[model samples]
Target: MTQQTLIRAAVVALLVPTFALTACSKSNQDQAQNAQAQLQQANKNLEQAQQNLAEAKQQAAEAKAAQEKQAAQKKVTEAEKDKAEAKQKQSEAKQASEQKTRQARSEARNQAKSESKPVCSDCGTISSITPIQRNAQHGSGVGAVAGGVAGGAIGSQIGHGAGKTIAEIAGALGGAYAGNVAEKHIRKVTVYRINVAMDAGGTRTVTLNSADGISTGTRVRVEGNNLAPLH
Candidate 1:
């Protein structure tokens, strides 16, 4: 080959390598761009997945909160119902206690009345004495006789018959006066009065006949025309 031919051939060889290297670099650059794009897409997918997961978690939390709220409401309702029932029971118990107390009072009053007979208040005894003044006359006469007899018997033991007779006369006169006064005083009946307090804050005055052995604070029953005195 000539010198000119050899130089042209050598130039062509160097240009071919340069063209090939340029083509290869261009191909590599395209590949790198594609990989970057794929990486960007993957990152976007990951972000989307994370967002979906957060949304699901939020939904679950809301559902749990709602369920807890419902459970708490149910418990409150049950507690309220229990409180109401307890209140009702307490009311019933109070009513029953009141009723029992009333019944006991009534029974006690009745029992007391049944045991004692009717009596009066003034003399502390019951007397069917007629013509109340006659009681005094009769008692005076009996006392006089008794006094005279006792006096005469004592005088006879200490003096003569005439002195004894005079003493009997004096004794009888004094005895009659005392007996008449006693009989007058004993003829009257006793009277019992009580003030009763009612449940409604009211008070009642109860009057009944008083008798012997009957005392204050005694339970008694007043019947028709007869007052039963209690011991």
Candidate 2:
């Protein structure tokens, strides 16, 4: 072989190995870049999942708070209703008590008025009647004096001296006593006594000069100190 031909063949052998090594290096770099991109995408997906879980927890907490508030409002409403009912019952009881007291007072007043009225059907009645005789209270001394003078004159004519004087004194004394008694008998009075029975519970007596057609069992009305017949 020629010398130039030998040199060209050796150079060609060396250049072929260098080209294969460079192609292998380039392929490894491309695989490393693809692995890095996949790692970044996995991290982003984990962050999004954590954010969604936090939002779900917040929503649950808000719902629980709303339920508690509704329960508290219901309790307050029930308490207010009970208070109103109690007040209404108390007012009704007070009114009923007042009405009962007024009725009692009215009944008492009516009873008092009825008790104070007078009973016209039972006032008084005539129980009995009786006649009475009464004598004069007294006589004047003029009757005795006149009787003594007439007796003395008659006795003086019967005798003389001392005997006639003794007879005149004795006769005058007897005639004076008889004349006083006779005057009293001549001045007698007659009266009637009436006894009345009162229905209010008592008795009364009345005196009259004559019986003016009054009798027992007759109903009468008692005035101050007098009695009048009932029709």
Candidate 3:
């Protein structure tokens, strides 16, 4: 309780003695009655203050409980979001795998049909084989053009007058040849270029990425652009 409440209690305690002394004198009966009334009012104010404190504690408890509940709900919501993302990723991976399988089978069938035979899922057998370098960028003549330009620039820097013109022409020719060679060296990959004789008596040319024990007369299967040795 407050200091005012404690002081009121002290004053009431003293009033009993005070009243007795004044009653003995019997000269101030009305003043003693006034003290008693004030003591009662102070006691009432103390009780009201106590009641207000109890209500405030209850409200604080309720607020804390509500905050905890909201945090729990938020955790649950975040967990659900994470679960949904994982499920979506798994579904995408499954679809991609299935699509890749279908494409591989379709490509194999097309390769089989290249032999003028009925389209099938496999690509026949190896009849004749050659080890060849395949350059991804060489067939378009872009290399030659770039090479010629670079060669002419170099040639123009070298000699003077008529000799410079001859040098440019010679450099261009040389550069074109070098560029073609450089492209083959830079972009070429080694593979066994094989002619496959289909079981259906039609021949198809196939490029296998590696020899991998495959040779002339070796039977093989084409799954998409990949080759597998026949068992």
Candidate 4:
């Protein structure tokens, strides 16, 4: 070929190769940028997922805590019920025991009176008289009065300001009922211990339901183990 033609052909060849290389480079750069964008998007998704997982864990923990608190409250309520039931059972048992004791005492007293002689009848000079205030007693209507006083005193210290009034009323009601129950079901009796000196010889002790119509130096009648003052 001619030199000019050869030179033109060579120039064309160089230009075509340069253009192909530039196109390939641009395509590779675009692919790389796309890959970077995809990577950024994946990282963002991962961060979001992580946050969601953290929130789920927090919710789970809060739910567990709440369940535990409810369970604890339920246990407390059950415990209180059990305590109340136990107290009721105890009170019942005490009442039964007292009844049994009373029956046995009555039977014993009857047997003793039948067998034992009425020694030193109407014998005895009352040496001393003592008056005792009985509180834990049955059959007197004293329980309600005592209970009201006690409950009021205790309730007055329970709350402050306006709430104290409400507390006092509630306490008084509860205490009154409790006191009545205790008196009827718990306390067997209360009495005075009387001692007597017999002119016939021998000192005797007796129990009286009340101190009325009897005092020191008072004349009394002795029947078996019992004693009564003269009218």
Candidate 5:
């Protein structure tokens, strides 16, 4: 063949080998770059997931703490109510006991007053009243002597000698006895006898010249030998 054609063929053959080698090296570099980009994206997504998990844990812990605080507050309120109720019951019991004690004291005092005894020593109740009469004076012998002398003189004037003497003696004796009886009747005293039962224990009798205001069932007081109204 010709010399120029032969040289051209040689150049073509060398250029084609150089171009294929360059293209293959470029494709390998591109594949490595794409793999590195995928790895970086996966690392970013993992970090975001970890942050979200930590936030959720923190919110759960806060909610638990709030519940615990509310429970503690409710227990404290119940305790305060129980204390107030106990104090009120104790106060009512003490008041009732004091009232009962006061009532017992009042009853005791009333019983003592009802059982007391009497105080007067000279007081008495009049049980009986009786009217009586007594002679104020005894007969004197002077009246008897005067009446005998007058009766003897009168008898002597009526009769003679021995008969006059016997009549005079009989008249004198009768006149003396009559004069004594008249003297006793003229001097008489009226009185009242009162019988009393004493409070201290015995009975006594009192004589009064007059029964003006005293009667049976009357209260009286003894003074020396007399009695007075006790009202």
Candidate 6:
């Protein structure tokens, strides 16, 4: 072969190999840029998903808190209702107790009245009369009359003369003696008597101030008197 042809062939061989290497390097660089872009997109998508998850968690927490608050409110309302019902029941019970107490008192009073005994209306019981001393001047009525006359004479002395005063004194003395005699003749006061049974079954006689006609075996109950079973 010629030198010119040989030199040209060698140059061609080197040029061809250099061009293929350049092409292969460019292809590899393009592939690397594509991979980087895909990685960036994946990171962006992951960030968006994380943000959505956080928002969902926050909403769930808020809902749970609201539910708990509602439950607490319901519990408080129920407690108040229960308290009101209890108070109503207490008031009703108190009213019932008061009514029962009143009924019991009324029944007790009726029982006491039923158990009471009747007594004589006239002379309440049989008793003795203590006689006043004889020759004793019964001066109660006469003293009242004489005192009035003496007071009148004293008052008359303030307005009238001696003649009026003398007449007043004579009238006062005469009226006092007549009243004394009448009181002595007519005052035959009789007293009533009573017999009370003691707890030991003993009988006691008591003198009363008024006349009483209580026959034997006559049932009697004194006023303001009470009897109870011995303890």
Quote the positional error of residue 150 for candidate 1 in Å: 66
User: Per-residue lDDT of 1-231 in model 2, one digit per residue for the tens?
Assistant: 988988988898888898888988888888888888888887888888888888888887888888888888999999988998998998999999999999999999989878887766447789998989887556576667777877777777778789899889867886676667666777777777878897778887877677675789888876655667888
Model 3 residue 61 CA deviation (Å) reads 1.4
Q: Which stretches of candidate 2 lie over 4 Å from their true place?
A: 1-32, 108-231
Candidate of highest TM-score: 4
Q: How close is every model to the real structure, measured as TM-score?
A: 0.45, 0.36, 0.35, 0.48, 0.38, 0.45
- Over 4 Å off in model 4, which ranges? 1-5, 116-231
Each candidate: what lDDT?
0.66, 0.80, 0.80, 0.82, 0.84, 0.65
**How many pairs of residues collide in model 5?**
0
Which scores better on TM-score, 2 or 6?
6
Q: How well does candidate 3 score on lDDT at residue 99?
A: 100
Q: Report the candidate with higher lDDT, 2 versus 3.
A: 3
- State the number of backbone clashes in model 4: 0
The parts of candidate 3 lying over 4 Å away from their true place are 1-36, 112-231
The residue pairs that clash in candidate 6, if any, are 123-212, 123-213, 192-210
Ranking by lDDT: 5, 4, 3, 2, 1, 6
Candidate 1 vs candidate 5, TM-score winner:
1
Candidate 2 displacement at residue 197 in angstroms: 35
| Model 2 residue 37 distance off true place after TM-score fit, in angstroms | 3.0
Query: For model 6, where is the 10-residue window of minimal lDDT?
Result: 222-231
Across 67-126, the per-residue lDDT of candidate 1 in tens digits comes to 999999999999999999999999999999999999999999999988867543321223
Model 4 Cα lDDT, one tens digit per residue, 83-197: 9999999999999999999999999999998898766656778876555545554445677777877887788899898899978887888778777876876566557777888
Residue-level lDDT tens digits of model 3 in 1-231: 999999999999999999989777775667778888998998898898888888888898888888899999999999999999999999999999999999999999887778675544465778788888767545357667778888888888878999999989988888877777777667767777778777656777777777778877777787666667878
What's the CA error at residue 35 for candidate 4, in Å?
1.4
Preferred candidate (lDDT higher): 2 or 5:
5
The number of the candidate with the highest lDDT is 5
Count clashing residue pairs per candidate.
9, 0, 0, 0, 0, 3
